[model samples]
Target chain A: MATDAPRRGAAIGWYVLLSALSLIVLFPVWMTIARALSDGSATLFARTPSVLPYSPIQWDAFSRAFTEGGLGRPLLVSGLVTLIIVAAQTATAVGAAYAFAFLEFPFKRIVMVLCAATLLLPIEVTLIANIQTLQEVGLVSPSQGFGEAIGALTLPFLAQAFGIFLIRQGFLGIPKDLRDAAQLDGYSDLGFLRRVAVPVTRPVIGSFVLIAFLSAYNQYVWPRFSVKTNRWDTVQLALRRFGLDNPDQLNLGFAAAIIAALPVLVLLLVFQKQLIRGLTAGAVK
Target chain B: MGKRRNVRQWALAYALLLPSLVVFAVFAYLPLYRLVHFSLYQQSSRLGGGERYVGFGAVWDVLSGERFLQGTWITIKFLIFTVPAGIALGVLLAMAAHRRLKGIKIFQTIFSSTVASSVAVSSVVFLTLVNEQIGLLRNVSWLSLKSPNSALFAAALSSVWQNLGLTFVIVLAALQTVPEELLEAAHLDGYGAVRRFFRVVVPLISPALFFLAIVLVVYGFQAYAQIELITGGGPLRSTETLLYRITKLQKNTDLQVGASMSLGLFGLTFLVALVQFRLLERRVTYGN
Candidate 1:
């Protein structure tokens, strides 16, 4: 009983400490939400930050953000671009990983090395030249149409080496006997990949998909530089313009930021497991 | 027949790899080749003038230039401010939430919630939070938003906060991998909690820590939106990282200088990455 008291006290102390830490961690996000929902006039003049939304929550900021801030178009463009990139990346990665994992071929080592080398050359390193390349390809021009701009946005990201490596790891984990068994059952190479390898590696593929979506959705630099016009701005780029272009409507900007972030947040909540797995994929063994 | 079969298999394998190969060639290898090519020649000052061959001069000028050096220093400073602090905070949060206490999941979720925030979102959140006039931290004297020197720190603060979720998640995962018996044995010994953590837990999770360090360093180097959205690399260009400078050159249509700077940034990143692997990999204790 004497020791129990101290242990209980320690537990309570931990609870308190953790609660405070959580608040600190959550404060920025909560404050953003509060400011987004608060009356613009009150928020502009308020000296102390309110912990919650001001009474009679002003929902007009969201409408203004959606329309006047031009968030609606960006949301569509970002979603379409993210979907295209994710789908293409998954297809390309799965194909490349399938070849790497299950097939024997000449110059495989050199090809693998070349693929891995791309990991070092991030988009930032290749930014200026890539822009030139896209321009040369007529994908990004002064008068580039909508489709060309979307191509510019999604082309460089169509295939990722990390995705290949991750999916290959998954494919490599399938036992040789399983492949042999499928082959003996008269399954063709592509057929075996479709039925056996893919089903077995769904978790890895799912993880890759979630991570790819998150990254594609959150992409800032490429879109910011590549897309010359506001017509094709991704949500991130749009938010930047919205915030910078509308300094007076700070609440509107905040509201748009929240609106932009909501999709990924919901995705994170739903796909938390795969997201964590994909993120920590290379961190662990 | 067997030769034909082998040839067919090779064909299929090559076919499967074609998409990635083409993309890599055009976007990755070709750009790298062009960057070198562009850096070797200087564009004429006239708008439509052709190129002039200037082998290594542009690269040397950019690499040795003041802006490059200053940007490099600022990037290094940004790394210094963000990486270690991010790691320490991650470890702290992970340890706090690693216990078997009730409702710990909620705390873990909260700690990692920032992972949902995109760079732009996180930047805007911090920008609003640290605004000069009506910001939550406006009254806080030490972190003055108007100061040039503290602008980098302010940007770093947003980065650190934004990255906390990823760091916490990764570290918490690492913490869960620590063996119960090992900790118990350390506890059974004369080692106190802090000593035991350092002696036993630290080495055990060194790989994850190393991984986190590399990731955070890369992230710190790649940081643009945070600086752009938060400080705009401003108050006398105090937060202008290497990437930021490259983008500035890009904006100015100085592709030659930008290409050289890009290569320089690449070289710097490669060197830092090499140093990290050399210095840190030796200490990482990978559990069997």
Candidate 2:
């Protein structure tokens, strides 16, 4: 609409800046993929080897890195943990949000304040005591192994304070009339939440779930502290150890990074709109 | 229908809330309880011991150390560097994009995409880009990468760049709240772009800037991955922030010292945040 006359100078300035930033941002990612394709030609000291895949691409690096990095076990573990967290957080946040937004309750304001206050407590602060508590409960018994340890790491993060708050903000936008009518139609509170609030706020829920999942998957500190065995190292830990500690295995490290990053990249591509909306939603509030 | 329905509705509400309450109580509130209790005692659970009641002595011990004081100083320095830099860059980049230009969508996406970067990934990318041997920045430094001047500056520079996206998005959203008519009027009043920006646009969007500053301050304190990956808080602990020192101390002897230092660091962060929020509240205009 504003294109009647091209603002050539302003447009050029914007273009140059954007292109340069993109190049800076894209270079590392390009290097990873290119290295993976080039039989590790673009490893740590390899420089920008080649943008294109070699004629006989060494696809073995992917499989090698996957198993060699002990990624298969953790991938399954992280995937399962991520799913449980997403489902649990989404269900919990939506339920809590519905209660806060629509239902009248005693101490609603107090509960809301409690929810908001939880946002400021850093997990690292409580992590030591939390680990001790988990040990007492047998959830973190070393004998139970890495898979169970992954679950322990995910449990504390299962009910996110910010997710509940974000969902509450979204649910507040739903007019009282729809909810009131739904209640009058002989539906229970839970039923009304399911039929009315959930359907209305599906997009926000989807976005929050994705955000929560990605956040859980990308978690570094919690897993690093909680997971006792390297066998249970999540993708992020594997990437860090490989990329930093073992420089000689640079090609494999690059391959590992590419593998680790693939899921996030795919998630971004798939839910670009919702991801942007959910992230910016915090600032908008 | 009315009376019976109201009772059922309230019951259902409690039922819906039960799951989250259970999880939070077990995981969050329980851990919080343990933390408070642990802070009061002299012994860690790892070492089964005859318990000694120290009361608030641990908190006292935490705040009384030179290490803790140095940590507070470094953390404050980091906050000072990152928060203002993040907000300013965010605003500048947003302004640069605010002009009615072709391909604005591309710019917005490119800038905002960094919001998705985990601290770990951001650190890796930055470390690789600035590695003394292979980093893109290796060749640009007049001083060798090993030089304290280049090393510390480069580490800070990478963190600032990585965070620019988050700051940009917040400021850009704030910028959208500024009315176009006000800008047009300022232009008609013969104010140039810079004058109009400082006079009209800035005041309107100061709230977002303030919020972003607080967020960045919290992030700066929580800066672990960046320091760990790029410099390992090293080249002689010159780049070591409070967290890095705490972690290192923990790995070495003196878990008590490390825990105490962490608590002290947390206390300082809380105090500064409270003070900043109060001061910034005066300048930030939230609404029309």
Candidate 3:
């Protein structure tokens, strides 16, 4: 690590410059938190509220955002959807990656190509068709409680190509001799996967989960077209609704945005490296 | 015995792979097939006009029309506004944080904090900042209602802010990999900090920079939520990018038009990716 050691005299200048940049970057978040806590939703727009919470920290707005603003349900929905997405993606990706890495099957090359090709046609490119498929499967207009929730939110993203690719690379990078040795030691294929492959590639799988979970949680477009009713609103859609419905309720809106961002903030704090690695995997060699 | 063992291996591999293959087939491959198939039809089933086969005419209709050309221009303008600004700021932040000074970790955390904010969250934050009547900036002397371009700039401002964290983290990571001895060698050669950076540091980090450029361009094309949220694709539809137009068509129930527009957007995305791979990828200096 080339830690660019600071010179004694010039350190002050670097500190000042870096501080200014930090303030600039963190300003929006500060503003958001301030408005969220400001009294009466009093800090509408014109006046810049203190970055620190202003007088009478609007505990009401937080409760209102949770209750009146129809936020809690979406939080639950987002949680459920994200949980399923992460679990399903990780499991399927592990299985497929293992198959690709160690097993011989007919159409193996074609299956590999198919996996790679999914990268090119991101859901944005196939929006209408996916919606149509969703409708055909009766997901778009489901009648009821759990089925509708699962159908619209979790079904579309049960698998991810990126996860498969990331974990496949993980499996392949393990030396062939190790797998052969495992087999010679009387480990079945599934046994080898459980005892060796998974534990060794846990970091790669961990990063993939982080990426997939974040993407699922942050989904905006799909929820818009899929969840026709507020009963199934994801956090992203509900936040947009708050903005649209109460653009003037600046405090409440920022409060909701802050609330929505909290989990991600905690996650990023804990797994910053994993998130970065997951995000930049495609860009790096 | 060999035949039976091979059969068993194939069955096990396929059984393990079935769930993922099925999901991809349904969600990824099936939709793509439909995208092409429905794009050929003359009219959407929604409109209740008797189906007339168009044989790609609908696609031609969407792409040839003025709507899509203007959309392309808006998307490109957004790219121009954000990409270079994002790169410049990213590099500056990366350099500033790369120092080994005391308490630098706090600065690095602040720089990367926006990565936690999703597109919708950031858009909401900016909507308040840029609101026309009660906006924080509304009373600023120069930026009144008459300022036509301010909203677009505001949208871009939010985008640039959100991008800061991603770019900073990536560039900073890349910067760490630049060999220290190389910088020392350049210093011994009497190259100033700026010259050393341009001659050696920049070349080494070009791969990271190139990656940012491609991702930013793709993001520019696909941008929607911010426009839809803050601007609603207007003060005058000025902020509507290519994806916005496609989404608008979808919303309005113009299925045929939306499908064609989707295809056009896909093509545009493909073309942009192809161009970057050809132009920038060739020049990228991957460090050993």
Candidate 4:
């Protein structure tokens, strides 16, 4: 009973700490939502916003943000590009991880070492020469449309060392006995991978999918440089223009910011369980 | 039969690996190889002609210049603020939520959400919050910090907030692995909260703390978005980091110098990472 009392007290203290952190995490989100609903009649920065839409909320801010900011085209572009990049990053990472975990080949150790060694180099350093290369390939020319622009934005992040490293760590957690048994039973490599390996590791795959999607969705600078046209801008580019153009319309900018972040937040909520497992899984190895 | 099976396995391995190899070759290795080549050549915009290979002159010019030196100093200053402050906040948050408290899962979710909010999003939110004219702090007179200084502080705040979730998750995971029996024994010995944490909890978690610190330092040097959004490296380039300066060189007036600067930044990042891994490896205790 004495031990139980201490545990209960400790639990209560933890509740207080959690409540305070929740407030800190939720304030910016609260401010964004409040500004979104307010129609510029409300004071956003004030301690007590009296004129905030108290009864019938304004939905017009959403439509105005969409139409005036030209966010639709960028949203579509970012979505499609994000989809493709995530698929590519996941496929490549999975394949490389399979090689690293299951196969023993000539120079296998060398390849793995090289992959680990390159993690420190940020992909930004290679942009200039790459832009020139894209221009040479005619992808950056004026004649090409949104398709080419999206490709240019997605091209650089297609294969990442970090992803390869992560998936390889997951792949290593699988027991080798299963692989050996499958091989002895006359199951081919691809068949065993499809039938056994992938099913067992679905949670890790889901986590990687979410992470890759988030990275692609939030990409800004690459799109800013490579797209070079407002017509082909992604969500981030559109919001940046909103901030720059209507510097006085803080409410509108805030509304647009909320809109841009909503999809990622929904995605996070859906995959929170898998994400936690995946992130902690890496540290375990 | 065994030899035949081994050959098939090797063939499958190579086939599975091809696409990743192709992508990395084009994106990472090819560009790295090309960056070295571009650093030597000069662009002639006036004549609309191709670059002439001018050898190591670009590298020499960049190293000898004062602007690059100033940019390096600023980047180091930014790192000084970001690395220690970011990791400490992460540890504090992690420790606070490490128990089975009510709504603990909800708190964890909120903390980790910032991991997905890119540097651009974080920077934009803070920029609006602290704007000189329309920011939240605009009307307060006791906020004696200058506008530019306030902007830098705001930038640091955004970075720390965004990093809080990542640091907390890592440290909390480490904290959870501490044996409960040992803590119970300490409590039986009449150890107070402060003494117990310092004497027992800290040493076991030191390795995670060390690892988090190294990552924060590397990321601090590579910061670009906050600098771009909040300060634009403005009010006399007070907030510019090395990566941001390299980007400005690439986007603004010059290209060749920018290429050289990028290579320089890459080298610096590489050196720092090496030093961190070497120094910090001594402190990290693997479960083995």
Model 4: pairs clashing at backbone N, Cα or C within 3 Å: none
Q: lDDT per residue, candidate 3, A26-137, as tens digits?
A: 7777766666776534554325524466676776777788877878988998998989999999999999999999899899999899888887777777887887777766
- CAPRI level of candidate 4: medium
Give the residue spans of candidate 4 off by over 4 A.
A1-14, A39-59, A141-144, A244-249, B1-7, B139-150, B251-253
Fnat by candidate, in order: 0.73, 0.30, 0.63, 0.44
TM-score of chain A of each: 0.93, 0.84, 0.89, 0.85
Which digits, one per residue and each the tens of the lDDT, describe model 1 over residues B214-247? 9999998899998888888887888899999898
Q: Alpha carbon lDDT of residue A82, candidate 4?
A: 91
Ranking according to DockQ, highest score first: 1, 3, 4, 2
How large is the C-alpha RMSD of every model relative to the true structure? 1.8, 3.9, 3.1, 3.2
Give TM-scores for every candidate, taking all chains together and pairing residue i with residue i: 0.96, 0.87, 0.93, 0.90
lDDT of 4 at A104: 78
lDDT of 2 by residue, B80-178 (tens): 667777777788778876666667777777776666566676666655557775555566664235765555566666567767767877778778878
**Measured by TM-score, how close is model 4 to the native structure?**
0.90
Best by TM-score: 1
Q: Name the lDDT value of residue A116 in candidate 1.
A: 98
Q: DockQ for each of the predicted structures, in order?
A: 0.75, 0.39, 0.60, 0.50
lDDT of 4 by residue, B195-219 (tens): 8898788778877777777778776
Winner by lDDT: 1
